[model samples]
Each structure stands twice: as C-alpha cells, then as structure tokens.
Target: MPQYKLIYFKTTGVSEFVRYLFSYADQDFEDVRHDITTWSKFKPETPYGVLPILEIDGKTYHQSLAIGRYLAKEFNLTGSNTLEDLEIDSMVDTINDYRILFSQYLWETNEDTRAKQKEQLVQEKIPFYLTRFENRVKANGGYFFGAKLTWADLFFVSLKPYVDFTIGFDTLKNHVALAEHAKKINAIPNIKKWLDTRPTECCIQEFLDAKHKD
Candidate 1:
C-alpha cells in the first residue's frame, strides 16, 4: 500500500468526507490538521493554497471531491458501472453545491447580510435541496445511489455536523429519509468508531461564534 497522508485545517470542513472514506475502507492515513497560524506558513507550499490535499506516496494532490472519488474507487464505495458512477457523481456534486452556499452564510462578515443570507438559506435553499435529497434516499432504499452504499452517502453524512451548525438546528429534521440515511452511515462499525474518537470541535462553529461576538 502506498503511504497516505491527508492535510487539512483543524476543522472537518471539506476534509471530513475524505476521512470517512479512509475509515470505511479500514485504511490507515496520516491526518495532518493545521490551525490558522500553522496554515499560513504552510499555505505557500500547497498545490492550490487550499485543502484538503491527499498525499499519496510523496505526490500531493488537491481538490476534496477528486480525492474522495479516487479513494472511493479504491475502497469499492463507488458505483459498479459508468452510468451508476455518473449518478453518484451528480448527487455528490449537488450536495457540494449546497455546502458552498451554506459556507457563504457562515463566512459572511456583514451582520445584516449574514442575517439575510441565513433567512434565504433557511427558508428557501435548505428545504429545496434536502427535500429532493430525501426523496432520492427513499427511492434508493436509504442509500444515496443505486442499491448499495456509495461515496455520495459518505459525503452527505459527513457534512451533517457542519450543516447542523450552519443552520443553527437539525437541518434534517423534516427530511426523515436523509436523517435515517445519516443514522445508517453513522452505525457502520469503522465509521462509528471514527466519529466517537474524532475531535468534536468543528472550527466552523467557533468561527460563527467569534463573528457573533464582534
């Protein structure tokens, strides 16, 4: 096996799904997390100056979804065929789209603007995507794609904490299928173990709290 190392911020952020992929496959990796101070010095050396980067052997690569897709294929969490792969990729990308939107709200500096974004996110965007995601899980019998677990499922489940914190409540409260899907993913032995042992402080929450206090 090639030596693997994952480099990211102290927060789960986009890297959490990649960690889930590693856990689900029972693969060992060096999870290197950096705080803002450390990240500043290291940023110049990174491929894109952004994480989460995966170092395979000694070669470094950037982009979270690309790394995730590569690992999913390696771990047999990917689709069985090209068409199935397309479906899984589509779902994963869609989930990422909403994540980007939520991140906008989380990072917004203007209080009034942030409040407006939150209102739109809570009232319009969250429901629009989650309701469809719920139906997709229902159609696939609780999985995100096809008849089996895929990286798409891991990707969505890994974002649960971040999503909940961004919305300031359970984002899946009305989306029963999505909630159940998350439950099933969390119940996986390796995944459950990782969740139980991983650091609990999501830096996104700290960022939001700090902003509120300003």
Candidate 2:
C-alpha cells in the first residue's frame, strides 16, 4: 500500500472530493488541513503556489481533478469505459465551472455588483446547470454514469453545501431528480460517515460572514 498525504486548506473547495474518494475506498491517509495564516509558509514549497496536493510515497502531485481522476481509476469510481469516463469528466468540469462562478459572488466586495452577479448565477446559470444535471441523473438511474456510483456523483455532492451556502437558498428545490440524487449520495455509508464527521461550516460561508462583520 502506498502512503498518502493530502494537503489543502481547511475549506472543502477542491480537496473535499479527494477526501471523499479516500473515504469511499476505505483508505487511510493523512489529511492535512491548512489555513490562510499557514498557507504563505506552505505556498513556496508547492508547485505553482496552488494546493490540494497529494503526496503518494513522497512524490508530490498537483491539481485537484487530476489527483481525483487518478484516485477514481485506482478505486474503481471511474466509469467502466472511455466514453463513460469522458462524460463523467465533462460533468466534473461543469461543476468546477459552477464553483468558480460562485466564488465571484463570495469574494466580491461591492454590494450592488455582488447582488447582480448573485441574481444572474441563481436565476440563470444555476438553473441551467441544475436542470442538465438533473436530467443526467434521471437518465443514469440516480447515478452519473451507470447503475453504480461514480466520482462525478461524489464530486457533485461534496461541493453542494458550499454551493447552497453561496446561493443562499435551496437551489435544488425545483429539481426533484437532482435532490434525490443528492439524497442517495448522502445516504451512502462512507459518505454519510464523512459528512457527519467533517466540519459543518464551509469556507465561503465563513469568508462571507467575516467580510460582513468587517
């Protein structure tokens, strides 16, 4: 067995799914959570000054999705074939796009600008993605690819809490399939255990709260 160490911010952002992957595989790894104060010291040691690095037997790997894909393949969370893998990768990329968009609202300092962006994201972008995701779930019989669970499902469900907090509403309310899909993933034994054990507060929510307080 390879030694594994995952280093990321305390926030879920990109590392959460990798953590989920580990949990799903019932693998033991050192989860190192860093914060802003410590990141500067840690940054120079990492490639590209970016994080969610995975150290496997002392060699470092960067990029969250790349690490995720490797782990997915290793753990059989990846789809069975190439086409299915492509589709799953596409969906994961789509969710990453959504996360990036939501970060704009989370970081924007101007109230009016932030409000406008938030409205557009909620009223237009989110629904568009949610509907598409819902349809995919419906098509796949509750999972993202086939009958079994895939990393795409884990990726989606792992990022959901931050997305919901940033949207400030129940974005899945109108999407029954998506809601049920989330429920199904949440009920998975490993995922449920992780959810119950992890930190309740999300990073973006904490950032927003602190910004308001300031």
Candidate 3:
C-alpha cells in the first residue's frame, strides 16, 4: 500500500477535503488523529507547528493547500496548464479566505456576535461567491475554472458549511445552479461509488450532523 498519512485533530473541516480527495481517487491513506497532548509530542516531527501534515514515501509535507495540490497532481485532478491551474488555485483561495475568518475562528465569538457574522456571510458573501462561481461554472460550461472536474471543484462542492450548517444558509439552496453544481460534481459515478464504499471520515460528516442537531 502507498504510505499516505495525515496527522490532524478530530475536527474534519480542514482535513476532510484532502481525505475526500484521496478517497475519491481510490487512494489508500492513514488518517491519524491527535489530541493536544499527542500533538505536542508529535510537533518535532512536523516541518511546522501545525497539526495537519501529510506524509508520503517517507517524505513529509505541510500547508493544507500544498497538500491538496500534491494530491491533485497524483490523481490528475489539477488542470492541464499553468493558467488553468492558476484559475483553479484562485477559486480555492477565495474559499480559504472564508474558512480562515469563519470556520477556524467560529467558536471564539459569542452566539450573538457569531450570529451577526453569520448574517453577513450568508446574506452577502455566500450569494456573491456562489453566484460568481456559478457564472464561472457557466463559463466553463461544466466545471469551476479548468473546464473540467478539477480538485478545486471537489473542494467547493465539499464545502457546504462555511457560513452556516443549514443548507439554506451556508449552501444557498435557493440557488439551483450552485446546488446543481455541487450535486453534479459529487454525483459522478466513480465518486459516488467511492464515497459509499469508503470508511467514514471522522470530522467532516460528524460536524455537519452536530450542526444540524444544534
């Protein structure tokens, strides 16, 4: 088996994308979870002071996006040329910006404060970004930026809870185009089969379920 390992906390929002990528590509990987104490002990092995690191072929890699790009190449999910890859990179970057402000820092604010943040994100940011991407999807006539099913498309389709866990709020369910975009990407036969057979992802689905509960 190819030795693909990812060290991460129990949360899935960050790690889940890569896991989904690997699984969809039918790549076998080891996902090791670390609590804070375990992470402190493991830090020396990390190139940086980060919990999420990927190891392949006894070589370690850092930076979440870099890992994504690496896996994209391995699976042939990145675009063909430099410009195409740049466009894919651009879309992923925008989503990352939202994640840094919202998902990563979500629980830090009080409920009332977070509600206002959520309102702004849902009312303005969500529609604006999704609509822009929808236009891009229309432009590409199928995919996000590369005129094909790139890793960036998978990344966005997997991102359903950036603003709010509720499909209506975070995902803009009213926007049929964006919804269809997500559905079409995920519903690809190979992806759907792989998803059904794959082991449960620890953090991502759990978080979505938990959000629905609260």
Candidate 4:
C-alpha cells in the first residue's frame, strides 16, 4: 500500500469522509490535524492553501469530494458498475450540497441573516434532505445504495455529528431507518474503532461560538 497522509484542521469537517474511507478499507494513514492558531504558519506549504488535502506517496491532491471519489474507487467502495457509481456519486454530491448550506448558516456574518438561515435549515432543509435520505436508506435495506455498504454510507455517517450540532437536535430521531443506518455504519469494526478514538471536540459548536463572538 502507498503511504497516505491527510492534512486538515483538528475538527472532523471535510476530512472526516477521507478518514472514514480509509477506516472502512482497514488502511492505515497519517492524519495530520492543524489547530486554527497554527494554520497560518502551515498554510503556504499547502498546494491550494486549503484544508483536507490528501497526500499519496508524496504527491498532494486537493478538493474534498474529488479525494473521496478517488479513494472510493481505490477501495471498491464506489460500486460494481457504472450505473451504481452514478447513484453513489449523486448521493455524495447531494449530501455535500447540504454541507454547504449548513456552512453558510454556521458562518453567517449577519446575526439576523444567520438566525433566519438557521431557522430555514432546521425546519425546512433538514427535513427535506433527511426525509429523502431516510427513504433511500429504507429502500436500500438500510444502506444508501445497494445490498452492502458503500462510500455513500460512510459519507452519511460522517455527517451525523455536524448535522446534530448545526440543527441543535438529533435530526435522526424521527427517521428510524436513517438512524439505524448510521448506527449500522458506526458499528462496523474499523469505523467503530476510529470513532471511538477520534478527537471529541464538537467542531460545529466551536465554529459557531467563535463566529457569534466576532
């Protein structure tokens, strides 16, 4: 196996998917996390000056989803064929769309605007996305795409904490299938091990607290 190094912030954030992909494959990797205070010092050395860069052997690659797709393909987590790959990619992209929506609400500069956006996110966006995902999970017999686990499952599992923190509630509570799907993924031996030992800080909370004070 080639050497894998992932550089991102101390929080789960975008890099969490990459971590989960590795964990699911039982592949060892170097997870390099940078605290906010020290990021500037390390920023210039990054190719795109961004978090969530993956280094294979010695070459670095940028873009979170791009890295995820590559790793999914590498580990056979994508799917067995082209059509399945398309479904998996579509689900991943849809999840990422919600991620961007949450980011906007989390980091909004205007208090009123943030408040409004948060309300919409919690009331409208969360339900819309989670309900659809819940249906998908139920339809797939607990997984997102097929009879077995895929990168889409890992991606959704990695988003649970952020979803809860941003919505200020257990968004999965009313969605039994989705909740069970998350539980099932988390129960996977390797993914469970990673989750048990990973950092405990709630990055979403810290991010909001910092933004609120500014």
Candidate 5:
C-alpha cells in the first residue's frame, strides 16, 4: 500500500468526501489538518496553494474531485462501464454545482448580500437541485447511479452536514429519497465509525466568523 497523507483544513468541507472514500475502503491515511495560523505557513508549499491534496507515496496531487474519482476507481466504488462512469461523474459534478452556491453564501461579507444569497439558496436553489437529486435516487432504487452504491452516493452523503448547516435546517427534510440514501450510507459500519470518531470542530464556521469580524 502506498503511503497516503491528506492535507486540508480542520473542517469537513471539500475534504470530507475523500475522507469518506478512505474510510469506506478501509484504507489507512495520514489526515493532516491545518488551522488558519498553520495554513499560512504551509500554503506556499502546496502544489496549487489550495487544499484537499492527497500525497500518494510522496507524490502530491491536487483537486478534490479528481482525487475522489481516482480513489473511487481504486476502491471499486466507481461504475462498471464507461456509460455508468459518465452518469456517476455527472451526478457528482451536479452536486458540486449546488455546493458552490452554498459556499458563496457562507463566505459573503456583506450582510444584505448574504441575506439575499441565503434566500435564493434556501428557497430556490436548494429545492431545485435536491428535488432532482431525490428523484434520481428514487429512480435508481435508493442509489445515485445503478443498482449498487457508488461514489456519487458517498459524495452527496458526505457533504450533507455542510449543506444542512448552510441552509439552517435539514436540507433533506422534503427529500425523502435523499434522506433515506443518507441513512443507508451512514449505516455502513466503517463510515459510521469514522463519523462517530472524527473531529468535532466547526472550523469553517469559525473561520468565517473571524473573517467577518476582521
């Protein structure tokens, strides 16, 4: 096995899906988390000065989704064929599109602007995307792609907490299929163990608060 070290901030943001992939695969990795103070010192050393980088046997690679795709393939969480792979990738990217909208609201400095973004996110964007996602999962018989669990399912489930926090409520409330899908993923033994034991700090929230104060 290659020596794997995952470098990211101290919160389960973009890095959480990769962490889930590791847990689901039962792969041991060095999860290196940084705070604002430490990140400043370490930023220059990264390949792109952005995080969620995975060091595989001392060769570091960047990009969260790319790393996820690689790991999913390695762990057999990917689709069986090219067409299935396309569907899985499409679903993951669609989820990412919605996640980016929430991120914009989270980091917005202007209160009025943030309020508007939040309204649009909560009232329009969230429902629009999640309704489609709910129907997708329902159509696929409780999974995102085919008859079995794929990385697309893991990706959505892993990001649920962050999305829920941004929405100030359970984003899955009206989406029954999505709620059940999350339950199914969380029920996995390894994934459950990881969730139960992972770090508890809301580092992203703290960082945003500090930023606004500054």
Candidate 6:
C-alpha cells in the first residue's frame, strides 16, 4: 500500500520499466495485472488506452516513460542535473531504437526470415551495438550514463539480462566492459535481495517459444 500503483498486462513488454523503478527503490505499490481476456476492460481505464498506468498518491501517470522518470527522480534515481539526465535519456533512446525491431520480430510470421533476422542480430547488430554501448560506457566514465546509479542506470541494468540474451542487445560474449557493468549492477545489495525474491513471469519463456516457434 505505497503511494504508487502500477497496472499492466500479465506479460512483461511495456510495464517493466516502471516495475524496475519501484523494485529498485524498495517502494511498495499495488500491482494489478490483467490477462488477455481481461485487457478489454483494463484498456479503457488508462490515460491513453494503455494497460500500464502509474497512479501516484491516487493521481494518474499516463505515459510509461514519464512515469518511470517521475518515480526515479522522486527517489533519487535520475541524474544529478539536466546534462546527466540527457545522457541517461540518450541511452534509453538507444534501447528504444532496438525495441522497434523487437516488436517487428514479435509479430513477424515468416519462419526462415525470422531466424535469419535473429542471426543478423547476433552478427552485425548485436556485436555492433554491444561494442558501441561498451565504448559509450567508457566514454561516459563507466556505468550507463551518470557517475551515480540513476534511474536510467537502474532501468537499463534491469533490462541487461534480457538484452544480453534477448533480441535487443543479445550479442554479449567476452564483452568485458558491458559484463562489468552488468556485474556491478548485480552486486547492489537491494537489487540482489529483490532478484532473489521476485515472483516469476512466464512471458520470458513465452517470448522464446514464440520466436523460435517457426
């Protein structure tokens, strides 16, 4: 019964960003999850006909990213200043760019092409982005963006597992810098505790099954 509450689909796609914030902050909130059969009813309640809605102290937070930023800033997660925030936003944008292809791959029907796309990701996109991100890490003085672990860092850190193995940033192997970032995030005591006790989501396996189904 914390001040913020999040409503999202049972699946992980859209709401996870907000989820990471609350979890990292060790804040409490109501989690309302709706299945497909329940989405029609759930959709209309949101500001933009979306499922993932954040209500802060009973007021509604419409956009997902806005909500994440708000919560992050409130809990000392965002950057120290506008410049740092911009860097964090840039990293977030990079991940968002790749997510476009992720959505495309999710709905694509062709079998051979999908596999080929995955391979392409593994070869050109994965390594390229990973290297680019790795370089960006060094350029920005290590971590994701700021010297301190901001919300942006937590958000991407929360997402690193999926990236290292999923369609977005999944080209990691002997990636020293990137792996170091991941390791650092993993070592956060609060995060470590949450990871140990968090509930399971089947959508992870579902994503794999759906992609490889062809």
Which structure among the candidates has the greatest TM-score? Answer: 5
Candidate 3 least-lDDT 10 residues: 161-170
Q: Please provide, for model 1 over 1-214, each residue's C-alpha lDDT reduced to its tens digit, 9 standing for 90 to 100.
A: 9899999877777789999999998999999988756777999999778888899999999999999999999999888899989989999999999899988888888889989999999889999999889888898878988768999999999998877877789998888778888999999999999999987654565545666777
In candidate 3, stretches whose alpha carbon ends up further than 4 angstroms from where it belongs are: 35-45, 161-170, 197-214
Write down the TM-score of every candidate.
Answer: 0.94, 0.91, 0.79, 0.93, 0.97, 0.81
Candidates' lDDT values, in order?
0.88, 0.85, 0.72, 0.85, 0.90, 0.68
The TM-score ranking, best first, is 5, 1, 4, 2, 6, 3
- Write model 3 residue lDDT over 59-158, tens digit each, in one string: 8888888899888988998878888789788888887775665663354336677777767766787677777777888888677775678888888776
The local distance difference test score of model 1 is: 0.88
Which pairs clash in the backbone of model 3? none
lDDT of 5 by residue, 1-214 (tens): 8999999998888789999999999999999999888888999998888898899999989999999999999999988899989989999999999889988898889989999998898779998998899888888989988869999989999998888887688998888778989999999999999999998876787678779888
TM-score of 5: 0.97
RMSD per candidate (Å) reads: 2.0, 2.3, 4.4, 1.7, 1.1, 3.5
- Worst lDDT run of 10 residues, candidate 4, spans 201-210
Q: 37, model 4: CA deviation in Å?
A: 1.4
Deviating ranges (above 4 Å) for candidate 5: none
Encode model 6's per-residue lDDT on 1-214: one tens digit a residue: 5487788766556566677677777788788776655766667767788656877778887776777777878788777789878878777777666655555665566778889888876667767766887887777667776556766566656655555445644444558887777678767777777678766653555544545665
Error of 5 at 175 (Å): 1.4
Of the two candidates 2 and 3, the one with more favorable TM-score, higher being better, is 2
Mark the 10 consecutive residues where model 5 has the least summed lDDT: 201-210
